[model samples]
Target chain A: MMRRIQSKALLASFSLAAVAGSVIAAAIIYAPEIKPVERPLPTSFDPGEVAKGAQLASIGDCIVCHTADGGRPFAGARALPTPFGTLYSDNITPDEKTGIGNWSFAAFRRAMVNGVARDGSHLYPALPYEHFTHVDDADLRAIYAFLMTRQPVEQVQPKNDLLPGLGFRPLLAGWKLLFLHEGPSTRDPARSAEWNRGKYLVEGLGHCGGCHTPRNILGGEERSSDLSGGIAEGWIAPALDKSNPSADRWDEASLFDYLTTGIAGGHSAAGGPMGPVAEGLSTVNDADVQAIAVYIASRMKPESALQKAASTVATLPRDVASQDPASSKSTIAHPATDTLFAGACGGCHMPGAPMQVTGRPPLSAVSDLRMTNPRNAIQAVLQGVAPPSGRGPAMPGFADILTDQQIADLLGYARAHFTDASPWPDLTAEVSAIRKEDAR
Target chain B: MTVSLIVNGQRRTVSATPDTPLLYVLRDDLELNAAKYGCGLGQCGACTVHLDGKAVFSCLTPIGATQERQVTTLEGLGTQAQPGILQQAFIDEQAAQCGYCIAGMIMRAQSLLDRNPAPSDAEIRRHMQPNLCRCGTHHRIIRAIKRASAVLGSQNGKGDAS
Candidate 1:
């Protein structure tokens, strides 16, 4: 009877120990370090600084995610689609209840720099704190001030419903350990101030690397291959590094022109993700633009030199008949064609037409004709020319009147006359495919 | 609810639901078209404006909350006759396309320059990241802001009309 009593006592002790262990485990799993934040009073603020902060916020595109579609600005609820799961932006307005009304300057800075929320929760990387990490304290203060002064909305963002293992907040702590770095360090004294500035902007707030730089398999930015180019949401963000094959060929003036107006004489137009960047850059100061230009120019590699040399060496034949298959005995075949082009296409296409329709692209300026891809030029020729649908009717299509051979000849003539590039491949098959796709 | 406010230095009154966003009130009722209707939520800087001289996303601001506050729109920043230094810089830099987000861009930039007359490129970029321009002119936009900074830096605080 005494032995049985002793055994029961041992069992009770073991059960109590097990329960204690479980409680400790739960605490470790759930509890995180929460830092205290000092809140800013609305009255004690600098208006000018806040205003400047507002502008910086605009350039950073704070509103894009902070505001939902047709919802109040900074009220959050914008769902950002990512590989892991959908992340909803939190309300940033100065509302005491749902917004960040009570966050201190230091807390705001921590969130922007370390991706740590006030409650010690890990903010998803989609907030781009990795890039924001480089932002200066003054700017953060200003942003905080601006946010504080704004009207607070009572909208609460939805919780991020992530997959099982991904939902754990501790996982982000490990991810941050791998990828997150401290803010921008001191600039290299040897480098030009402009270059340093460009470097900071490109690597930091502009977060050009976020899009332009390719990512690793883990979805982390490939730091070694900076500005090499990447695909984001089906649009290709071109290589911004100096080694770009196209950059070496484009002069600084052309680059400046393109950045300023979203149109350079020839190379390419600002489309896809670049369009908004160009618009934002247009608002930047000339010195900064020059700094960017200086940086870009410095990055040009030898490949650009080769491209330029090749471009200079290849000249088009003046007479189409010299190479025409059907015009061996007929000089009129070439001259007649020249006359037809001069009358029909020369007025707009040769010099470049003004786009009258919305979203209608301008015609090939001499530089555009020189590009490696002749698809645009070929399409323009085959389709004759139509005004861009929404914009203007600067050019009209003549596909109904021109035969396929004539169209091909016109394309050949364009290549010879405007660019030194080789003739385009036979696109008859591709054209049919495009037509069918368009019909669908 | 009826809210009395000063917009671009002009006293005005707006009548709307208390919960109605100041963005809609400014764009729809007051017809101050500089602030845009980008994403209705505040993710885009397209709807940034100034409340009592501080930059705020107007879309998130409710009319009821802005009572007696001074509001400034891009139109208030400057006009064709006498454009703000930042506005002039934006035009000189050719900073707009689609012009859909220019007002917000200007407001944001103006706010930045107001705080730091000479911001570094990184600072400018960080400050401007919240503003989305689908056209990808960020490189130039940074330049334009720097240019405006230089312009503002050279002036001896003469343009603080507000």
Candidate 2:
């Protein structure tokens, strides 16, 4: 009986030891290192340093993400939609209660470099700390100085509505271990100073890859498809690499022009999310813009002839069909489309028409015609482009002006007459849906 | 603070902060309406002008940075009565749409022509790429530049032959 009792006691102790071991393992896996941050008493900074900080902020494009439309700058509350869910941006203003006004330099550094909150909770990589981790100490200090100098705004940001699985902060500790590469990057010795500067801005602070690079199932950027292309804010961020779809090669000059001016002559226009990025980049130094162009050009190899042909649609000038000797034979094949185009669009779109020479983008070379998807084209037709601010001659929306059947017919004609592209899928349903949604 | 500038062949002085963009000084102080303010940042070449004969965004260039440099705007190119060769070519080709981006386009084109008196169609397109024409006058713009290049070429040839 005594021996039996001893055996039971031993079993009990063994079970206790197992439970304790499991607890310890769980703690190690979940808990991040929580260090106390020390901050000096607040003091005014040098004006020059503060000015430099402001410039750096512009380069980083802090205002675009932080400020919601029609909201105070840097007061935050911008809803960033993601595949996961909508996450709200935080107020970075110097409000002690609502913003980062009370955050010490050490606390700010920890958050920027380590992606940790003041309470030692893991921050979502959505903040882009993965890239900002490479930001040098001097820039970080300057940013901190700039934020500290700003007027303290009293506003609280809405909580992030992350997808259910992402709500658990401890899971992010494992994510950090898997993905985050903390510290400054090692520069390649073979590269020029300009190339390195471009790399720094594009990879480190600009975080172009964050949006441009495709992501995996877990939301980390897919390493194999770097800058090949990705989707952001419901628009496709086209491949910046050799896979860029422009018929002509993007030389350094063209790339520089595109970045600096938001347009590359006949190539493409900056719209959607990229529009703001282009505007922000315009504030940076000319040399830096050049450097970025140099870096991007270096990545893109000259495309193959087959690839170029596949990419470029034969956007013949308007006079081509009307004047071409071979057009009579081709016109016989699709007389209905020809008639539809002439009636619907020929008024202003034909060669030498006043609107064609004046306000209208040539039907032949417009970026929308070349896109693989018909979304931009359909949207432009249904809801006409408002000429940019102070750049007047706004095109009227065709939602009320044209019937769905007529739009589809016109689109079909545009594809046949203006471009060599395979006709985009019938867009009648899409036009109808968009019009209904707009009405609502 | 007062900043002295050489604007469109005229020496002018304006009171503004040293860091103020030259585009603003030209617009607000000198009242030169040709150089537009499309994007306060230089993303739109509407604010492009020649600084020391090189095309630069006036919106991005600070007033302090332009000391002792010649700044040329579209107004300097020529007025409505007597347009320069490039300006006249643009008019002949109807190369402008809204005309907001025209000043910068002309300036960029001038810089290209100055460097390369006879640029190929491809070279002209590449050089002129920096100036955006949102209305898509690019094809016509190319033609105008080529037309101007031919005219300039003939003029040069005649001078040399004589």
Candidate 3:
């Protein structure tokens, strides 16, 4: 969020650069429209290739962004609110009218790898073509085959509402020139085949860095800080590298458990936007997920200062309000929220609780409570965690149950009791703000 | 391990493992049969009780965690002779078929009414989402909650039963 402020400040200079860049871009921004073809029957695709494509699609989490809330999968009206402005996802359901039903393989490839649409319009980077460009031709073809076979949904996604002057499509060619590296990714000679595959998926279709890496004002990922930390859907996707705030290191096993099942023993559960990602990966093949774990774990090295900061609180701090004689006059109920914790959260979060005995991470181990931003914690509380694998403890959201002040009190109590991190200032206001944001 | 709990405003010491769910302590050790164990996983609200005025799953809240909090079960709300407003509403409305989920439904509903004395029917349904009634007794249970809410709202001074 702090980085976002700095990026906003540079917008004036970037706008000047963009105007000059667009001039150069307009000269060479031509893409010959590939002729349309009749919608291919599902039977035309090889079953095995279709199945493989389905797996790849799940790994890519195609449905997460493409599908609008409570809308048909891949019908695509989901409004992706970026710092620049709101961009709507494209309908990729193969609908004859609105979707990619008429898209030929060449047209789809151009769009997938080069960010060009069937009508020769440049797509916003919201599609992550920079990463999609790394995917091999065969894999891209498989994905096309799978998408063409899906239930054809007739939906025309709303046009992107971008910042003024940013809507000029040719300007994106300049962005692509500077950012998009179109080609199959190279293998690291030192790494294993599985690790190489992991890198490909992570860099290509998985596009893990899209949410995990902070973006520049131009919306390109900050390559220097790949997967260090970033914001996703208003929640902090904590750093996955050496700067990871978890007291415990993310090994292959932990990463595998987390990526697949949502919850890992020593680490926090896959919360926020990652919830659906983990759930989607649950149905994927174990080998691919294992490979992903291998690469992700390899990235997570130990940093003592961060680990020390993340370590569980040695002792609970005394409540500062108890010293005040007027403390009993507060609106929040008496006997402290530890009792509220005992009631509302104790079942899954308290030490020695049932979920904890099953090797679930305690409140002390959960990174949300320990993170610098309170948004993740606030989001998790207001909108409870879904049991990732469908068997773990599924928490009911307290948004309807608890007030903002009550939620603030409970989290305040948790931070003081569980972690040594400095308490978040104005948690109640933060909760209210997050609630308002989610409402939008 | 011995755990001290403030149950029904009476300080009681019970010898049990620290991690044992408060549901077992209330039903087994303390012999308070009010909170029933329909689902140990907290999906069913049969084991819900008011822990310091907030309804929580007693089946999940460990006895260890309850040491610092005040625990109130169905028995604490009212005796058989003098039923609480919610309990009376349930009785008047005939909200139960098998009566297993009644206690939990009452506790969960009571927590909502406590927070919002005049919650809308939609709000009641949303608040009671976690609680389940297997006997298909939801219609009556909702009626009972509405009945109690109307009573509480109409009353000039709140009954200090809770």
What does the interface RMSD come to for each candidate? 25.7, 22.3, 6.4
Residues A1-440 of candidate 3 have per-residue lDDT tens digits of 98988888799789989999777666669777778899999999999998999999999999988999768999999999998889999899999799999999999999989999998988898898989999899999999999999999998988888889988988888888888888898899988999888989888989999988988877888888998888888788787787876524456777888899899775688877898999889989999999888777667754343345335333223332222322332224334565556556765665566777887777766778878888899999887777776576677666644678878987887776666678789999999999999878
lDDT per residue as tens, model 1, A1-440: 99999999999999999999777655544434455544467677889878777766755667767888668988999887666767899999988678888787877888889888877788788787778899888878888888888887999999886766787776676667677887673586887898787666556666767777888766677778878877554344667765453554555555666665565544445544455566666665666666665555555544345345446423322323224323332224344444344333543443322231233322323333454544444444433332211122323233333444555555555555544456567645544444443233
Give DockQ for candidates 1 onward, in order: 0.01, 0.01, 0.07
Off by over 4 Å in 1: A1-43, A159-164, A251-253, A265-267, A301-352, A356-440, B1-162
Give the per-residue Cα lDDT of candidate 3 at B113.
87
Cα lDDT tens digits, model 2, A202-260, are: 77777788888988887888757878878766456777787765434465676786777
Q: What docking grade does candidate 2 earn? A: incorrect
Number of the predicted model whose lDDT against the real structure is largest: 3
Error of 3 at B131 (Å): 5.3
* Tens digit of per-residue lDDT, candidate 3, span B29-145: 899998999867677889989888888878766665566568888888788999999999999999999999889999999899888887777788878878889999899998988
Instruction: State the C-alpha RMSD over the true interface residues for candidate 2, after superposing those residues.
Output: 22.3
Alpha carbon lDDT of each predicted model: 0.65, 0.71, 0.81
Candidate 3 docking band: incorrect
Winning model by DockQ = 3
